[model samples]
Target: MKKLVLTGAAGRLGSYLREPLSQMCDRLVSTDWTEDIGKLYPSETYVKADLGDLEAMEAVLDGADMVVHFGAIGDEAAWDKILHSNIIGAYNVWEAAARKGLRRVVYASSIHAVGMYPKTQRIDTEVPHRPDTYYGLAKCFAEDLGSLYWDKKGIESVHLRILSAAQVNNPRALGSWLSYDDLIHLVQQAITTPITGFCVIYGVSNNDRVTVDNHKAAFLGYRPKDNAEQCAEEVLAAADPADPHDPGQMCQGGPFASVEIGFSGTASMNIVQDKKEI
Candidate 1:
């Protein structure tokens, strides 16, 4: 590819992606609201821009072949904050991609989009959106926005409804863990696939207790290598008895399902700040 744009360049997942994406394109343009993202790859350049600014998004996406959108608050937040950063930010990215003639958008969606579903039900990409929080609602909006753009503007998109792309320290993570290696593989497939008009796939690993099915997305060739079972013994050994009545324990969204609309879900998840420093 000639040029590829990556939003949320300062984020944890985005940090891991910068080097790899730089290798895939002749020029990798990374953008974030931060002033700088430290050292860049040989083919990478940093663009300090906010996702809420349509003009900035347009300037950042100009001439890019595709975009890997990961910008936004990754946790449940107040409605106003979610509105500006996640909802409006998404519009700017998609609108800019269409106006710039980008080929596709590999969006970083979330499991919260269907967070209300019971963990017992093995859901798929086609399930209706049942957002658990304002953050999840934003994801639902972006997924629909992507669909609308494909139907109306011929812009292609692949929404990866990511589960838990973090360390597996809890029982719920055993079924939702998506290792960083698998994340890169999924993004690569979403970007290189030949004829994906608008697709949705779970960003999860090949865990023994995996909850979501990805058979419909087999064409994308996303064969996840890592599994959370390796940590099952330790996690289960220290696991607390799950209350069947708690939505956090019974629903696919875990803590997000139980958190208040404006509360932070990641705060209770004990997520490590393991950003890949380049």
Candidate 2:
């Protein structure tokens, strides 16, 4: 790849991706709303850009072969905030990618897009959207927008519905955890795949108790190697038994399923700090 653009470059996940992404392309443009990204790779360039601005996104996407869109508010907040960052920002990305003639967009969608489904039901890539928050609703909209752009404008996209890309500290994480190594592999597959019109795949490790199915998206070649089961005994021991009637515990999205519209579900979980070499 000649040029690759990564949004939300200052974020926790982006910190791990920057160096590897820089290696994949001749030039890697890392952007975020923040002014500083601390340390930079030799081939990596930093830029401050907001997802809400179409012209800014267009400029950043120019000459890029592909885009890894992880920029957003990342939580269930006010509708106004979600509208600008997640919803409008997503449209801007697709439109910009279409105008710039980029090959593909790898979006950071969340499992919250289908959060309302019962945990007992093994959801698949093709399952209908059951968003739990305004944040999740935005993801669903962007996914549909990706599909529209593909059908109408020929832009390719891969929407990865990540379950839990954090430490396996809770019972739900035993099935939902997505190791950082697997995350890098998943993104590589999405970018290198020969053809991906509009694909949706669950971003998860090969756990013993996985609740999501990726059989339909076999073409993307994302085979996760890590298993959260290694930490299952400790996590399960720490977890309190779920009430059968509570949507939060019984649903696939876990805490997100029961949180109020503007509350932060991630705050309730103890996520391990990411340690990346600067």
Candidate 3:
């Protein structure tokens, strides 16, 4: 491809994607609201832009072939913040993609979109939305937006309903973790796939205890290598007893499912802030 745009360049996951994505295109335009994302990889450049600014997004996406949209307020937050960053930001990405005539959008959707479902039920990508918070609701909106654009405007999109892409510190991560290497592989598949009209796939590794089924997305050929179960003995040994009745423990969304609307679910997870840097 001639050019690819990546939003949220400064984010933990986006940081990992920068170096790899740069190799796949002649030019990689990485955007975020941050002043700078420090160093850049070969063929990579940074752009300071807000996701809420449609005009700015249009400018950043100009001449780009595809966009990997990782931009958004990551955790549960106030309705106004979620509306501006996640919901409106998603619209700007799709709307700008449509206006720019981009080939496809590889979005970073979340399990929170279907977070209300019990972990016992191994749901698939087709399961109806049961968002756990304002953040999750925004993800649902983006997934639907992607579908609408595909059906009506002939735009292509791939919504990767990422479970948990952080450190395997907690027990839930044993089943829900998506290792960084697996995440890169998933995004690569989403980008290089030939004829994906509008797809939704779970972003999870080949965990023995995986809670979701990805058989429907077998077409994407995303074979995740890492398994969080490797750290299971250690994680489990250190873990406290889980309450069966707590939504945080029983539901797919974990903390988000149990927390109040505006609160942060990630606070309780003790996720290590380890971001890959180039």
User: Global CA lDDT of candidate 3, please?
Assistant: 0.96
lDDT of each residue in 66-92, candidate 3, tens digit only: 999999999998899999999999999
- Residues 147-197, model 2: lDDT tens digits: 999999998999999999888888888899999999999988998999999
Error of 1 at 26 (Å): 0.4
Span of ten consecutive residues with least summed lDDT in model 3: 269-278
1 versus 2: better TM-score goes to = 1
What is model 2's C-alpha RMSD?
A: 0.9
Q: Write the per-residue lDDT of candidate 1 for residues 25-129, one digit (tens) a residue.
A: 999999999999999999999999988999999999999999999999999999999999999999999999999999899999999999999999999889899
Lowest lDDT block of 10, candidate 2: 268-277
* Residue pairs whose backbone atoms clash in candidate 3: none
Number of colliding residue pairs in each model: 0, 0, 0
Off by over 4 Å in 2: none
Give model 3's TM-score versus the native structure: 0.99
Candidates' TM-scores? 0.99, 0.98, 0.99
